[model samples]
Target chain A: MAERTPTQTPATVASPDPAAPPPRRRRRMKDLRKQPGFDTMAWFCLFCLYAPIAVLVVFSFNDNRSVVRWTEFSLRWYRAAFENDGIRHATWISLQVAFVAMVFATTFATMAALATTRVRAFKGQTLTYAVINQPLMVPEIVTAVSTLAFFVLIKQVTGLNGIGFLMLAHTVFCIPFAYMPIRARLEDMNLTLEQAAADLYGTPFQVFRTVTLPLMAPGIVAGAMLAFVVSLDDVIITLLVGGPGETTLPVYIFGQIRRGITPEINAVSTVLLGLSALLVSIFFLIGNKRK
Target chain B: MATQTEIRDPGTPQAAAAQDVMIHAEGVIKTFGEGAGKITALDNVTVDIRKNEFFTLLGPSGCGKTTLLRLIAGFELPDRGQILLDGQEIGHLPPYKRPVNTVFQSYALFPHMSVARNIGFGLEMQGRPKAEIKTATEEMLALVQMEHLANRQTDQLSGGQQQRVALARALAPRPKVLLLDEPLSALDLKLRKEMQIELKRLQGETGITFVFVTHDQEEALTMSDRIAVMQAGCILQVGTPKEIYNNPARRFVADFIGDINILEGELQQDGGAVLLPGGASIGALLPEGAARSGKVSIAIRPENMGLTAPDAADASLTGEVTNIVYFGAGHNVHVALDGGGEVLVRRAQTDAQVGAKVGLAVPDAVQVLVD
Candidate 1:
């Protein structure tokens, strides 16, 4: 690219020189055209990435039952989704599960981040960090199976079957997702502020409350959002751990897709996508405000 | 200055008679990490910081100066030792319980808080009344000349402004002793110089004992009433600036404090002079150990030596001028002797060239270091 820029400059500079040969001038013009050409591969890659999402979004308002056939633009699927009993119940369950998982996962992850990043070296610190990040490294199916087996054992010991178990599974799976951002923030924080707080007559707990916690607020919010999104979108863990009446929105969508493709699923998915995008924007705004 | 002389010899009867001992650290040892990777940050260090004195701990990086400061502030507990503040052993107490505050090197101003809030944070932590905190915060802001920036966020302020805010915040609570860990190091040269004097003035006005740590020897000399020169976790010497510079107790102290040309020689039989290997006998204060060993190093400050004609009668040694370094105010004439040693004589702008033969005249009060 740099070589081309130099070559093109000489061509324009020699444009008014009649002494220059016509063939060479024509070749230079061709070269100039070629140098300013568009990157086809980049456009192809972008299209490949966004085309499916575009199709999903456009087809979400399809008037026909078949998602592939768009007879006319209509809001029937959205209205139908809102009025459906099973979808509504599953959406409510998903909201409850996501809220619970987000709160617990964010709290536990923030503690883990502080313990690993703020505290100095201790016995088994590396092992503890690795254990906290275990779910992120393992396959989601493996986590689903292990959590299913663990919940089965718990149920055998004490008869429990409800959204509570599903919420616990989602929280366990979302911990690593939440841990990443919170730990990164803690590591990036300047430690001298906390030391200064302590030196300024703040107790250990007071230092955390006044300095560390306020500074780590953005990371906590981001981590909570990430955990909420992960729990809301989870299918395998919910399917494996949930019993009857505990089917979340994603699981219901999967069941509907397995039965048949419907515009209602697309409409529900678009809404979820919009919700996640809104959350991500909020995260970025908070991050920028802090900066 | 009189009190400085009285506390100069901390181990002597004069220092024991003085009633201004604010903090006394005895056999303080701190180690980091464990096993093979362990580092002894402070090794059996003992020192006494006097009341209302601008005492500085001067050393290079990793010299345990910062560790000592942190130990005094109760940020880090000593592995084994006692730290007594106001005659009470408070080594095991947490930082909040101690009557001390620290101005960290990075300023460490709370980025989220305004300058006023940052200054008031300490008083708030102490559970002071809201009205009292506001008054004290405003007073501290005025002390640091930062009242105009009272409501501004700390992150919006310049480096010097943030530094003032940090100082104001630390001083608002009126700590008995204040620990400053290279607070001026982050500022530019001019700002650092201004703050050095400002800090001394503040210390004088408040009558708070300041334990400042810095690697810059000039800053230590200019601002401190007395300095503890540390190296490798040990305090080599503790004395006033004039005493530390003019009568360094050890070779490291003499070399670390300022530029000096060390001349290796043997102590004379009378124990009042050193016989140089370059056929020159110079008067020196011989230590008892050097008297027994007959070996010593004569540390002559470059400014203390003079350059003269090669065959001058008062010249103690003769050498060829090897190099000349100009410092605008003066020139350092590097002289090489026939006996394979070099000495730098500081001179004003002179006609002496690099290859000119010159005679070096040493003053009578050269420091004689045994180690």
Candidate 2:
């Protein structure tokens, strides 16, 4: 109990000068940030990821016909993409699918998220969560193949071969993308706010309309945007499920690639990339603003 | 000076009237989880809160004060028994169907709504006319003195401002009863003191039965008309501040509310005088129907006893001053008695020296505690 530590040593304390300036210490935080090779490794990884996309974007504006070798900047490929009947028709189809799928997916995701989060623990809750997020975990190729087989059987039974099958496939796959942000938002939401609303004489439906919906608007918008981008950029599922002449932009671009590599393909891909980037940026903005 | 504030027998003609009882909870029990993980939050609690009274539930954490408040608010339903509001059983009603509102401990204001809109929410939900809702909302804003911040979003306000908004919002609908779950706990000391007075005034002005819950004994004493002291999911005692402080029904209430010294004692064969551990005797102030001849525990408030000379004839116990702790107003003298126990004595000024022998002169206010 009487043991003395170094700080309690009388000799060291007595030896210190009263008026001397203290020694300058190196900051540990700045030193940690400047760890050797870290900056280089980070930049190299970013470059590896984005360098090919950057090349594709630049080549999309090439004046020459060669896809990889850019000679001079021109809007010729963009103009060609705009004027091409097949590309125009496929893009319109893609937009319609994305819009319709986004609406349905966001609705289902919101309901599913609320069901899983805003209630007491019940049987099959874990399994319900798993099923909601199943599409996100499963491989895209497997989903595409299964949907293709399912739609083929449906066509034979119903004697229908409309674009409904492709729309259904996109909507199904986009659910988990939409569900992720919505469920996260619902989880982060304060439970007491809803309780307070109920305490204020708002019925269950009224509380949902007045309090829960308004607070959840940002998450719903973000989820919808993410779902739109995901559906718009989908290639495998669209290709597998689309009927003749019901090709989407990504599938149409795939068919063009098989025929021959053209600067027009780069142009179309760049447009798709830009659209996805714009929507994803909007999604991020809405998501981050909630905090 | 308030005494005999216990729950009267319901079979009495006066007790059955029910007009003054704003909220009555009978044999209420609430438990969380199921099977082995179950924890009973409230155990057979039954109490009556009078109309227009600032009633408070005071206890330490997990003592079921907030749980009881929530039960009255209709946020949590009792697994057994019934809660009555003005003689009507409301235990089965949902929160929205019940005519009560809560100022949550966290002050759960809607972040998206402006101050005025938030206050108007309950009115709007009731489908009141636009003009009436606006008038009531404006009146509530003026009541809480937040009229200038009417259009400001809730997230823009400070802690105290948000607390006022929450109070205003809950009060807008003018419910018959208001449940405040430690609303002032989030405030700093000076602000909390201010809000305590403000809440008491609001309760008076609105004539709403306020069931406040807090762990702070000072807050309960300052604001409540009557306080219910709880421990381990049961109400230990129910009385006004004076009664609770002076005549604690349980040792837990005595030790919890203020500085109290409990000593082991025994009642004499004739039940006239109680024998202290240090061979001193004092007249027994036993409650009716209590044990007449047995070992018992006794509680005395620190300030109620005085320090005297070691050989004083009227001394109830003798001890040595072990420690002296100073506060701005007074000091507490910790004493180690010769009978192998410790007691704390509060003194405005003490002449006794540390480690010196002293005598404690017990007053007639010594409370005999039941187990």
Candidate 3:
């Protein structure tokens, strides 16, 4: 029919091939070979992103104290950072905080995403979403100050003191980060699958469990990673709200930086940077797999 | 010319109630927007969909055809009517609670799930035993001939392949009714034609009531056991494909269904002959007790417009062949009438040419659209 129609019909040629794979491959090949100004601009943008990470990797192996200057290569800081008890304890605290915060963040983000996208009408939806995103919108200092004030007020009423409040505060900040990714994932998801599931004898709740939740996993995983990063790196919120013996890694690193220049601090920073890099690499490896 | 009209549904009112009517919708009304200015999507539409039948809601895009499909699927709530599934009022029930499924136009297979998982999802939700889900999923996958790709992710499959997976997924549970909303509309023309046959085959194999919604005339005609042609928000007519195409009850139905050569004529000769608007006389074998008088229209299929060179006086509107299009299957010739209006003649491409002056016989091509 195509052979016949192409000979006779004057309609525009939109080949019925839905597999656009070959064209995409050919386009990439053509662009690489041509190397236009647009290619230079794109490469320059990539260099802008990658150069700092390169510098950070180089500095991790440097013997010098400064971030830029390099001396003889050494693994001394990495070894020392691994050995320091304060750094180890702080790392453990950050891990605990991130782990706990992830649980809260994933749950809240999922519920919030569902409520935002599903259900016909809900009272104060925009307000609820804005409140969920408060940690991201308001200044970190403001959040810290508010967390302190809220904790003090709680203590004044009925004392519930500990870094537990600090964890909760960090969870609040991680929500928007988590919610951002989950919501974006939800936006990409097609609603027809849920409808199809329902039509195929699944109850609304069953459809969510079998269809919607499974489809949203990738997004939930992304949100969890973002939440973990936020929780681990949080300084202002933990600094103001964390109680005794609950100093987070960033707080510990802050104190060290203020004190004096030392290989121990560099060692600790290197370890922290390594963990983040590991997490980021895993995130991309899992998340960026194409169909 | 008082010939009898042998309608399948006898004119007696009792015939409407006595049948194996699987679905009964009573006076369904749906209105969008609110208050006095509300737009009526379905205006008191009442239809009975029979069991194991291929039924189509055929109409233009916004003619409440999809709204009716949704109403049947429990996705939509009619404003002031109840629908009964197996004689139980289930219109108010949500889509999940209803014993029906839909094959969406988008073929919405879960992108994250493997084809087997996608098809087995409904069984999993019902807490079916693992072995049962596994066996049933395999059978369904085999039914759609997608068993080979069971472990493959849905997003990786082609559009037609994904559509088959969606079909397997929907048909896995074996619902009482299968509502398809323009299911083949998203596919390429060749694939759409292929899926049409596959859908029909599957419908026969499963023996479930299929409520298909489509704006394509040929798709509706080729697939449905009965088609309900709708306009605006009202059903213009409902009949078998042959009935709708061969004997259209309205002018719009004639125009919408397929290529029809329409000739405007004044009702004359006490309903014997029609004096065409272009002053050409033509004869019609009118249906008994049909149109009355004055202004009327005559419609005939393009193939029914026969050519007799240019030597006739009392024939279908005599026209000169302006252009001929070779559509592979047949030659569609465009003809300009000597009076005013034009005529389209479709003939076998075996022996036809362009710019050939021809006289069309109007004896069979004339029908009293209005009288």
Candidate 4:
């Protein structure tokens, strides 16, 4: 088997030489062309996915109020978005909620992921895994409505309603999103290192702090970024559960859309899109570093 | 060979007192899973490892050797007994509290740390001074001859190199005992052989009780001062390598340790002799209280049987050579006996071709086993 590998390369390289007969060359070209439409469909899907976002980004610089028409290129809406007081307040609220939610979600999700992946097999392991992932399996609108009802019930019983409620709702919704990467990282880890650490006089907590946690950093960072993005972009749940003075950026943008289609909305959406792209790029950077 | 005779009688008071026992496991039982799915990993396993001796748990995979090692290391808790280290009961202590370290089968080096850091990690966990850790880490690196690769990440090292680093790391803290779980199983045959010698040298120099676990019988024989052969969660026998190889206590032990030919026969009226069904009589050791009429099994090592010309005067049995397997060091001649049995004779070199008739001679000390 080892000897055959070196011989195989020269045969493949020599077959593609121009010195080869034209008939065989034509047959090889035909074979290459005979591939199925998977590549074409992939290209089509990519264009479909990115074209809308590209258009929205381009129109964010439009001078005119209309978003559909291509007018003179300007930063008019960007300046308008920056100047708007309501947008600014809503952006602040969204940042606060996303930051807090990211922290709590990442912490709880990391713990949940470790418990589900690292713990030995138990009777309720499968059930616990399913329950942790329930938020991702349920529809977004259902989560929003159910959370709203739950909050209403809590308010009826204890009368607690504020930005705290919105933050809590977002944290719950973002848990599965954060959990996925952390769990994947935990599962990918070589468990023997932890065992070796324990054998080398490291206590359980010491092993976790010295070996498991450092190895899990990439996944935790990625999960935190994902949770942040999800919390930042959430609109339905915020609209349903948020009280006055608790409007997030997405909720504010939805209100602006209902009032009218403005380039300012496109400008804000472009900024949000850029932020998410930056977060995603950071996630990939950490992932690549781990590799 | 001299050491083998010295430790031959493990029950002797002088031997037991001279070599202080390091680890003692008493009626240890461990089971995995619950109810119907439960699998008994170790069943009432009791063994004493002498201080500073190179002890081995030798068996095939799933024979509970690794479970026994883990039990002593405190990675596992026994359902029904105690494990003692230097006369201290350590069964209730977690792995970290136990004064033992394991070189994992996978090497399990911390991929993110440098070789030096990996070797120093245990010391750091002990809260050793930085200067002391540095000096000790360099000493360990020197011991393993990995000083040139001290700064290299563990992932950058080869399998053999990583194994050394793991050993260095486990040894840095200078534990009273070290456990190695098939540490050389990942290396190629040549490197595995080299590491085997190196491991023995290290164990001798450090004078730490080394409990090595492996399924490779040759490796166990080459490295262990004393070996405990395990099967089906029970210890079949414990003896020196020479003792285990020459005088196996069970059929499984005989078959597992090395090449052997087993012949079924009945004990003759004259003791110390077995009569085959084909009317061939072979010398053997008769067990005490043996039934004078029932069948018995005799086992002989392939190397012990000699091959002679068919017309030789003292030939006990005649057979036709069926096959010859050449193993560079020696060759095995497979013979089909005329009496409806087959045996293999190990020879240095043989001009005997296939289909040549050969005479076989069985030694006097054939192992007799009664079922």
DockQ of each candidate relative to the true complex: 0.31, 0.33, 0.34, 0.34
Q: Which is the leading candidate under TM-score?
A: 2
Q: Candidates' lDDT values, in order?
A: 0.85, 0.87, 0.79, 0.86
lDDT string for model 1 (B85-133, tens) is: 9898989898899999999988999998988999999999999999999
Weakest ten-residue segment in model 1 chain B by summed lDDT: B1-10
* Winner by lDDT between candidate 4 and candidate 3: 4
Q: Candidate 2's C-alpha lDDT?
A: 0.87
Give stretches of model 2 more than 4 Å off: A1-32, B1-16, B269-272, B287-289
> In model 3, what lDDT does residue B268 have?
75
Off by more than 4 A, model 4: A1-34, A156-159, B1-15, B268-294, B309-313, B323-327, B349-358
Fraction of true A-B contacts recovered by candidate 3: 0.66
Q: What is the TM-score of chain A in candidate 1?
A: 0.84
Per lDDT, the best of the predicted structures is 2
Can you write out model 1's per-residue Cα lDDT over A68-125, one digit (the tens) per residue?
8779999999999999999999999999999999999999999889989988778999
Docking class for model 3 is acceptable
As a whole number from 0 to 100, the lDDT of residue B28 in candidate 3 is 83
Clashing pairs in 2: none
Ranked by DockQ, the better of candidates 1 and 3 is 3
User: For residues B153-208, could you state the per-residue lDDT of candidate 2 as single tens digits?
Assistant: 77766677888899999999999999999898777777788899999999999999
